[model samples]
Target chain A: SQTIHQWPATLVQPVGSPLSLECTVEGTSNPNLYWYRQAAGRGLQLLFYSVGIGQISSEVPQNLSASRPQDRQFILSSKKLLLSDSGFYLCAWSEASAVYEQYFGPGTRLTVT
Target chain B: AQSVSQHNHHVILSEAASLELGCNYSYGGTVNLFWYVQYPGQHLQLLLKYFSGDPLVKGIKGFEAEFIKSKFSFNLRKPSVQWSDTAEYFCALSTLVNFNKFYFGSGTKLNVKP
Candidate 1:
């Protein structure tokens, strides 16, 4: 069975602080990774996606950026956080054969104050 | 505007009541459809998916959805609802043109009353 793990289930960060969220998948290889942000009353927004290591695509350009450092490890980082950056962040993985079907992680709740 | 649209933002239903949630997409060409559920305090999980073959697909938890190609609509249905069904439902679509990208609708919050 495949499992996706995200760190810092919940975090509270002050404005102008740096942000880092990690996501790693197990039991799968060469999986496509995605980063999404979900806000109240708003649907999930795709922030970035990666097909392979060091390859990243930005869906919605903002202050956030994503990097695939390893085959199974993905990192979302920001030099300085904004109040609008606070939301529920989700990490998802899909097999290359079936990119349409995705498996999501438990998600990280970051509150920027 | 969102490419995918979920008409129901919030719904309150009693146990045993029938469920029908409307989902519409604005993309053309071959597309894959999916329905996901997020129970309170839990990760989002796929309820059902439609790639091809049957237009009507059955998902877990006694839920089903019918895809109407002409209408560009894939509506979710449930014969009877339960208290445990109270959760958030999201409708998503991915086109073959960009299989790696998915567009999600504004989720519908279902509150099932006991």
Candidate 2:
């Protein structure tokens, strides 16, 4: 069975602060990872996706960035956060062979004050 | 451009009631379809998916969906829904050439009362 872990489950950050969210997957290797953000009452917006280590594609250029430091480890970071960055961030993984069905993590709820 | 549309933004039903959520996609080429469910405070889970072969796909929790190629629609159905079925449902689509980028619908919030 494959499992994805993300943390911290919830965070409260002040405006203009830095941000870091981590996601790790177990029981799978060389999986494609993705980062998505959902604003309140809105659908998900794809931020970034990584095919392999050090390879990332940005869907929307914004204040956030994603990195695949390891085969199973993905990180979302921002040097300085904005108030618009407050939302629920989800990390997902899909097998390289069948990449259509994506498995999502519990998600990180970030509140910018 | 590929996009997915979920017809209902929100639906309320009683337990044991039938369920049918509409999903339509706009894509010309061969594409894969999927229905995902996100229970309150839980991650999105695959309820059903359509890749090839059979147009009718059955998924977890006694849920099913039919793919109509001509209509370009994949509507999810359940004979009887429970209170536990209250959650947000999302329809997604991916083309063969752009499989990495999955387009999602706005989602439908289904509330099943006891």
The per-candidate TM-score of the B chain, in the order shown, comes to 0.97, 0.99
Per-residue lDDT value at B11 in model 1: 97
lDDT of 1 by residue, B9-96 (tens): 9999999999999999998799899999999999999999999999999999999999999999999999999999999999999988
lDDT of 1 by residue, A26-100 (tens): 999999999999998888989999999999999987999899989999999999999999999999999988775
Badly placed stretches (over 4 Å) of model 1 are none
How does each model score on lDDT? 0.94, 0.93
Query: Against the true structure, what is each candidate's TM-score?
Result: 0.98, 0.97
**Model 2 deviation from native, Cα RMSD in Å:** 1.1
Model 2 Cα lDDT, one tens digit per residue, A12-77 = 999999999999999998999999997655677789999999999999889998888899999999
lDDT of 2 by residue, B5-108 (tens): 88799999999999999999999999999999999988899999999999999999999999999999999999999999999999999889978988889899
| TM-score attained by chain A of model 1 | 0.98
